[model samples]
Target: MPSADLLLTDTHIRTLDPAQPEVTALAVAGGRIVAVGDTDDLVRDWQGPGTERIDLAGAHVLPGLVDSHSHPVWGLEMATGVDLSGVVDLDGLRGALRTADRLGGWVVGWGLDHNAFEGRPIHRELIEDVLGGAPAFLRLYDGHSALVSGAALDAARITGPRSFDQRAEVVCDGEGRPTGYLVEHAAMDLVYEVAPRASDQDRRAGLVELLSTMAATGLTGAHVMDGSGLDLLAAVEEGADLPLRLTVSPWCMPGVDRAGLDELVALQKLGGRRWRVGGVKFFMDGTVEGGTAWLEHADCHGQGTDAFWPDPAAYSEAVRHLHAAGVRTATHAIGDAAVRHALDTIEALGESGRGAHRIEHIESVPDDTIPRFAALGVAASMQPPHTAYTKGDHSDEWSKRLGDARAARAWRTRDLRDAGAVLALGSDWPIAHYDARKVLAMARVPEGAAGPAQGLTGLEALEGVTSHAAIAAGQAAEGGRIAVGLRADLTVLGLDPVTAPADEVAEAPVVLTVTDGRITHRGA
Candidate 1:
């Protein structure tokens, strides 16, 4: 084993730098890499009395996984929440609800799948029966919609199920009664508010849970979305012993205007001290499964998809606002329309350097819009796992809505890369489990376990999770690779990434994670 300033040898390491892609030895001193080269040669020549020497026996070591996007802290809460991923019908729901707690306020549970229900919607009456006194809110795995008890509507002050507008999609029955289902942004927000909000303590504890689970999954860094960015920073500073480095990319909903942008700017200025505020996050459209995702083409299922834009014109201004104020922008655009709208917002920059505007999800980026992204200098912040996402049997009906060709482009890492778009990978945590290797495997698996033509090489996929992700964040100097003078943040995997098989990636243990020379996590 090498000392704090040790020389680890006999290692096939992917430096992940274009100039020099491979190195046998990686030298760490004072946390930042001091040197990297032939272990035998360096040892024979530069080895010092204090330099600890360790043997790798030719294992493949690469830079630690820098999860480009995820809400690690937020994921912790969801993980602790009820596991409703497989409940399809009321029979399954009741069986699981035997343990459902009567939390006094809103008895909230998440990760329910509508694919299991008839018409793909959970009836509101069923929820009300189980949730007698208080309101109850349950979220779908994608976080796009919620199933609420009738009590939830009263808590929110909705007089009748009919009172709610079309956007909310309260799911009225044939008799115009509340059906217990909510869809799109309206349902997402309305039902979310009904759920118990995480208090400061709850948030802090979530971080603790988040960091532990993240480290266990071979992740060393993450970009947290949706949750309060400022609160995360405060929690990080409050002595939260999270091994994972944090990048807070909090949500900036439309209700937030110029005044709010100013506050965000102030927060951004203060960010990057310890943990960083990676970019400005905003919702441009809704989720597809929830029927909120904007559509240029009609739903193939004959049912219309939601293309509701929240103040479209203001988006360009908002893009410029974040850029002019000097905060990077990452917008959540699940639909093709949202993706196009966001790109158009960036294109409006028109000779103004707004930095890299990120287009989240890109589930259905049209071919024309694909090439324009690079020309427009926008990074496609996409989910690589969705490469395998559509393969699930439950997605067949949703696939019917997407048609065929467009649906196949779910995780277009290679296309985005070939189009000259910078590709940054994320799990869209909670939407899909936040597993870095799964992202890598999906990127290479092409068909993501479905289409052989779409699979990428391991290296191409690894880059999406590493250096490329670093470049997207405009932190080329501080991140994505193991190099001299760069901050000493590295992950020591038990196996070498260069040769580690896909089956082994997800389970590959991280032996040690060194952040600034301190071993934050160690697993044998």
Candidate 2:
């Protein structure tokens, strides 16, 4: 009716809507699905001169894929400089640094793995010679820490340990000299502040390019985990349309008082047509590899007993404040201790916080913590590809740190699903590759790096990125299903995601992508 804006025909639609599980055609008008039924019947009735119709030629179409955890806008800056993701050992790391290009007279590289050190502590002395006296900053793969060359430590004027509002540390030697290892956001910010940064124009352009690249991989929406690029998002929309819809959650770190809470609450009003500040992100713990994962017991390195928040009660108070304001929250909880504390905080909120809170990166948890997710209505937001950072034989840094028992429980995707929890999946880009297909593939099949962790079924994995994703975002009523009156966000693939082999699904051809009733990407 009213001249459909878009009509897709000759396709097998996997409408997650229970009422109509399958349909051949769907019509869209004003950014919402207008109708769905037999191709001939719907097209004959809804098609008009103004309608833009496309024949999918039997491709399989599903609800537009959503990355539950991503940092597309912020990642442009985080992922800049030379990529060290492929470097495997300290020698390789040194070689990469020797050949790394400079940015504003400083050598910068990201995605450096801790295993490259081969059990050696992360110290500038390891790579200072390779830098040849130039200031160098390298981001550890976890994104929670950084290793700077001695020159960089001097450049940032970071002479010794300092206090931070959060659980950050400027790692130092026994002699009281800076070791060039910065732990957590605060310590890393010291160097990053003085480091050269891209101009506002370059950052905006990079965001557009990065998001467009994600669209080519079949992403129609993303639950951006940080709120750094709100102004850039608004600026981009002012000039042109954003390739995907983004639900941003600004961070609420430790030491926040009433005034800071008020500032975060007011940020909820900032948004553009395709992006909105819907929730607040919090970090309950740093990363396992960084020796700060808040584990119940000490790691092999005797670290991880501390939470990211200097005062655990302060974090609980902040969550309570946000929950009272009808705000949803997601906390980074990678270790069992951190996960337990986060759940305990929500449990104290009673029925109101049941489904309003979520736990991100439940990397290793006890058996008891599994069922509480469904019981408390807490969504389990996990990144499957993160397992790639480990090794099956317990040789990688993450596995060795946790020992045998804890590492065995790594990324319990299937267990959480079976326990009736809302399991939302993503690639935590900048931490892992952002390809949505890999998220599905890794979820369905636990490769060697996953270390005996159970994987999800095809249908279950599909729901992780679709239905469960929407439930996690509290948008279950409008998105995640192909039905009349739902948002016209859809992804067309060369094969059915639910029936295809995991490997095949990983490389499935993205035939087309539609966001908000407009085609964003189409393959030849």
Candidate 3:
């Protein structure tokens, strides 16, 4: 009955729309879904004159995957910086650093997981040996930590460890000497404080290139988990001219003083229609591997507990302020203490909770808190690679630090789901490279690298990465499903995800990604 602008048919459609369940065809009109049914019904009732129809040829079709969290610039910049993610050992690292050139500037390298390092601690002298006075900076794998030289520190005007540090701490040793390692939020700011800020043109270019990169990987929508900079996103917009669907979650920085949060919230409001203000990001703890991630137990050097609630009253009061003002709160809480702290703060905000405050990571949460997340309706926004990455030899320390009981609680998505918590999965890119499909692989692949027994199923994982992720982003109404009346944001895959091999599911090529009724990306 509805005249449609286009008809997409002959695909096994997992509508993710429970009402009609599965459909063999999809109909679109004016860039909005018109109907979905058998090919005959879609063509007969919805297809209009001059309708552009696509024959999917029995491939898989669904709403485009929405990546819940990632630092887009950080990952791509690594392409231009030192990429040590692939290094196997000290020798390999030395070899990579030796080959990395600064094009007449300081050499900055990203993508090293502390777990990826061998026996030796990351030392200042060691960095000096490799980089000498070249003014170099190396970011930890989580993008939450870094190791920099005195030259680089001086260039940034960091007279002491405190200068390079912000919300995160800079590591120092006995006698008040600085160490090369800066943890969590500390590491991220070090680059921004000292490293050259990208020009508007450079940022624009980076965004364009990065958006194109995400499209190739089949991500139709993504959340900018880091802070905001219009200049930086220009590059993404240039590449994705169709208006990429992005949500910007700004970080809470201290320098702003009393009105800082308020002013920044207003600034973030300029994301326009295409980008929504998802939430405000506050770090409750730190990244798990970095040892800054607040844990119940002591860290390696006994810097007290790595994780703490961070002035619970203040944290609670802040949430109340945000909740009262209509901005959602999304905090970084990797270890149990952090998660517990985040939950407590959210709980303190009372029923005025207008937004879906989420706990990013929730990696090493306590068993009892599982129900708390669901009870409070807080989403457990998670990344899968933590499980996969830890399954190998890198897991030993985490196992020892967490012990068996706690470690078993590591990244319990299934438990979270069963306990009634919303589970939203993402790659946490730059930290992990598994694509839209790869994040799903975490749900279906074996856990802790032991085998299939630990893995989740394709549907379970896909829901977390897709529907649930969209829900967490507050775009659940239109972003996660394929159906009539829904926005025409979909990803056409070469293989059917429901029945495809786990490996192939992740590797499956995206035939096309449609946004707003126009084909933004199509495979050659």
Candidate 4:
């Protein structure tokens, strides 16, 4: 028998395997687990003169975590921009812009929440004054709306009202003049087209930094749900050795034709050990806070729009086409109506036979709609940390728009689990913090924050980020477990999360992270 390349011993390992749930030691070779057994026994039999044996000193180990839905590229780009998540009022907003202006170049900021402004109307004049005539664009926390300075508006050549297929509106003053606020991607893209883009080098550096951070936070894999697959591929080709495995999902926007579908299908040909274009992403509706999600009815007399595809039948047909082509689909569906539409489309497809389809951000679902997820074998990709942005007292914009009853049903993770749905949790990074520990912590105590009675048990929450997450990404066969022959991706924590107190679980440090038999992160 070949000697193992590395041996990890003297640890408490939770394999998440029913047959052998716990083990003290494991051996890795050629990027895969070769054996797992008693520490002394494995060391005696598998350890070699050349083997690298690391004593874990009783640290707890589990399968390396998988974030079922995230936007790593977007997160990195946001990092380069001014972070307005901490700004509270108009003064704070102005201060943030001023600081960003000092950084030089075009001023761009994200994570501005209008709810924090105490109902102060955002206008072009206000932003123009802050930057002193500099070109600036500030995106709301939801990523569904943005405010631009007058210079930015001019740069984009937006002087009048514009229409979009996706219900986006360039807010207009009574005189039909464009306000600074832009809603949804269609409107936001106008400014982005003129905004200075991060250079390839900048993106490469940012991605490397982001991956290292993810490894430290206990993530060995992520399902990247955005249009940056090509960028990731380029980064890898440029000799950036990413620490985590990535399954990229290229964005498949509404109105895509057969040729577009074929283009997306071709992306599947690009696959390597570290990355693969595993699926296509679609936005069924916009965010609730943006007043664009396809709610059951108008929220407080605000008529939410139709699906992004404009024609519901066309959206369903697109899903059918993709499903027929053996491509997995993950639709961003926040409102109950949007979630139902996605679920209905998947159900109508009647089993793609390739992999499980997914619904991203089922933020609001009717009770009856919960069971359909399991019934249709759709994975529920959710982010518990997103609830942190809300007050839970019905004062936040989302809750106020959703009203008391619907708000109570936000992110029904437990209910979905109860209905036998596969729960795959993530941070949706750039929207929320990407730490797996924080996600686990939030899932375990989501009551009041996300919604009453929405919390999961500690074990269940852990599974959401591990086994279930892997299942969602279609990697359960080769990863997500500590069985022999599975990829040697593991996260060593300071304590056993299952048996530890909630605080301990939340605060437990990642002592080490191993992916493909290689130690990606190690801490004393």
Candidate 5:
């Protein structure tokens, strides 16, 4: 047998494999686990002159963590310029804009929370005075909308109101003048068209830095929700390997025709050693705070009754078309109506669609929607850290918008798991902090944001990012466990995550990280 390329010994390994639940040592060859046994025996048998062995000194090692949902490549654009996530009110917002950095002559910023507006209608006039007449574009934390200055509106040639293929709106006043509050992607893109963008060189560097940071936090892989930077990713992979694995999913928007669908199908064949374009992303509705969530009933403001798609039937037809071609899909459905519609669409695919589809951000849903996930074999890809956006007392924009009844059901991670759903957890990144540890911690003890919602057990929380994450990406056989013959990806920590306190788990020292037989991060 060939000598192992790498060997990890003196570690407590939790394989998550029933056959080999625990082991003292493991060997890697050709980026795959070669063997697992007693530390001394495996060392004597597999270690050769070329083998690199590490003694973890009693550290706990588990399958490398995978963030089931992230947008590292595209988040470069979304998280650009200054960060306004900490600002509390309109005054704080003005203060942030006044001190914000400019990108290509524009006062660009992101993470502007809807709560910062203080129930006031958004308009350019609020921050225009602070921007010094520079064209400014500020992204709301939800990523579904933006608030641009009048200078930006002029730059994009947006006058008054316009029509969109999606349910986006220019958000005008009594006089039909755009209020600078652009709701949804289509409307926001008007200013984005002329907004300053990072150069490909800057973007490539930023992505490398971002992924490396994620690796340091113990992330070995991510399910990238956007495919915009495929060319950039391909270039990076060719020049050098990515620090983590990425599964890219391009979007299938509302206006796609048959030719567009064929284009997406052909794209599934594109891949490199560590990255691949595999799935499609669709938006069933916008966000609850933005008044775009497709609720079963109207929100308090009477504005959450519509879907993002102008015609919901087109979305189903697109899914059917993709399903027949054997391509899996992940749809962004944040409201009860949107979740139900997406599930209904997948249900229409019969048994074949089961397990082949995922619904992202199942933020709020009724009791009936919980069981359908397991019964239909659909995966619930949720972000536990997103709960931080709401308040436990139901005073936040999201809770107030949904009223008490629906808002109380926020992020039912535990309920869905109890009902036998394939639950996959992630940090939406730019939307929330991308720390995998925080994700584990939040899933187990939701702190104060979840409003008395039951948290997952420590073991179940770990599975969300490990085993269940792989199932969400349809890579259960190729990865997820620490068994022999599986991919050589592992995360070594100072303590056992499953048994550690939630607070400790969030701040646990990451001792080491391995991806594809290569050490990506080593902590002091």
Candidate 6:
């Protein structure tokens, strides 16, 4: 037997493997777990003069966390721009825009919520007043809508009201003049076309920084639910070694032709082990707060819109096409109607061993739809911290949009688990904090706070960010478990998460993180 490259000892390792649930030590070689067992035995057998040994000092180790769905590039890009997440009113909005104005360039901001405006509609005039006629574009927290100043509208050549096949609309005033608000991607693209894009250098730096930040939080892998896989490839091409593994999903929107599908399929084969395109992503409905989620009926009598696709049948056909091509499909479905439609589409494709078709943010679903997730083999990728954005008393914008009865069903993690669905958890970073501890904390106390009886057990919550998340990323066989042959990706914690109190688990510190046998982060 060859000597191992690295050896970790004096640790309580929770392997997540039923065969060898617990071990005292593990040996890594060639970026994979070569052996795991009694610390003394492995040390004596595997250690060599060239091997490096680390003492964990009785820390608890588990498989490194995997964020099943996140927007790494988007988050990093937003970090460089003004963050409007703190804006609570029109004054705050103006203040943020004013701050951005001082920074110069095309003033870009994100995380604005209309609910914070106290029922006042966001007008171009309001933004123009702050920018002093400078072009500025701000996106809502939901990412489904945007507010652009008159200067930006002129730059984008957006004049009167325009129609889009994908249910996107440019809001118009009573006189049919364009409002600053734009709904859905089609509408938002007009602004993006005119807006200055981040330089390749900036994009590469952002990706590297974001991945490093993720590693510090004990994340060894992430399912990047964004459209910028090329940026990651560019970073790698520039000789930047990513800190963690990434399974990228290209954003696939409605009206995509066969050529567009081919482009995505080509992107899938671009990267090596550190990053790869795992699947295609779609948005079925917008969001509850945006009044774009396809609910059973209109919440608050708003007449919630139709699916994002111009033709519902065409959307199904697209899923079927991808499923047939051996590619996984992940659809963002936050409302009951959208959830049903996503499930129905996946079910229509029949069974296959290709990939795990999933629904991101199954925030609201009918009771019957829960069981179908398991029956249909659809992975439920959800973020628990998203609930923290809501008020516990159901007075939050999202809750009010959902009403009383449906509001109680927000993020039904336990119900989905009880119904035998595969629940994969994530942070959806930029929208919420990316720390795994906070996510676990929210998951532990979801009852009454996030949703009625939606809380999950400590072990279940752990699995959501570990094993289940790996499965959702289509790496079930190679990672997720701390078996002898699995990848050497591990997270060393201060205590045994499964045995500790939920609150304690949330506070537990991450002592170290290892990805592919390389120590990415270490804390004293």
**Which residue runs does candidate 1 get wrong by more than 4 Å?**
1-6, 41-54, 78-80, 88-90, 104-106, 118-120, 126-134, 161-177, 184-186, 197-199, 227-229, 301-308, 351-355, 387-389, 392-395, 446-450
lDDT for model 4 comes to 0.83
Task: State every prediction's TM-score relative to the real structure.
Answer: 0.88, 0.99, 0.91, 0.96, 0.99, 0.95
| Deviation (Å) of 202 in candidate 6 | 2.1
The whole-model lDDT of each prediction reads 0.68, 0.92, 0.71, 0.83, 0.92, 0.82
**Candidate 5 Cα deviation (angstroms), residue 495:** 1.2
Candidate 3 global CA lDDT score: 0.71
| lDDT value for model 5 | 0.92
lDDT of 4 by residue, 1-524 (tens): 67889999998889999999999999999999999989999988899988999898868889998888888877676555888989888888878887775334688888888676666566877767768778888888887889888888998999999976656889999999887989888898998888887777777776887888889988998999986746565656567567888889988876688899889888877877688888989888888877888888778547575666688787788778877887888999999889988888887776563246899999878889988888888999999888877777878777887788888788889899999989999988888778888888888777444764788887888899888988887889999889999999999999887777766777788899998888899976
Better of 1 and 4 by lDDT: 4
* Runs off by more than 4 Å, candidate 4: 102-104, 352-355, 447-449
Per-residue lDDT tens digits for candidate 1, residues 358-431, read 77787766678788878877777877665543553325445656767667656556677787777888787777
Candidate 2 per-residue lDDT, tens place, 1-524, comes to: 47789999998999999999999999999999999999998889999999999998769999999999999877887897999999999999999999989999899999999999999999999988888789998998899999998888898898888999999999999988999999999999999999999999998888889888899899999999999888899999989999999999999998888999989999988888899999999999999999989999999989989899988999999999999988899999999999999999999999988889899999999899999999999999999899888888889999999998998888888889889999999999989999999999999886544543578999889898888999999989889999899999999999998999999999999999999999999987
Give the winner by TM-score: 2 or 4: 2
Compared with the true structure, what per-residue lDDT tens digits does model 3 show for residues 103-215? Answer: 34787788765655575677667657767468777877767678877777677666555743234666677755667677666554655576755666776776766776777
Report the candidate with higher TM-score, 1 versus 5.
Answer: 5
Task: After superposing candidate 3 on the true structure, give the runs of residues whose Cα lies further than 4 Å from its correct spot.
Answer: 1-3, 74-79, 163-167, 187-191, 234-243, 254-258, 264-268, 304-310, 352-355, 392-397, 446-454
Cα RMSD for candidates in order: 3.4, 0.9, 2.8, 1.7, 1.0, 2.0
Candidate 2 residue 521 C-alpha distance from true site, Å? 0.5
**Preferred candidate (lDDT higher): 4 or 5:** 5
lDDT of 2 at 454: 72
Q: What does candidate 6's lDDT look like per residue over 189-220, in tens digits?
A: 88877787777677777677778878887889
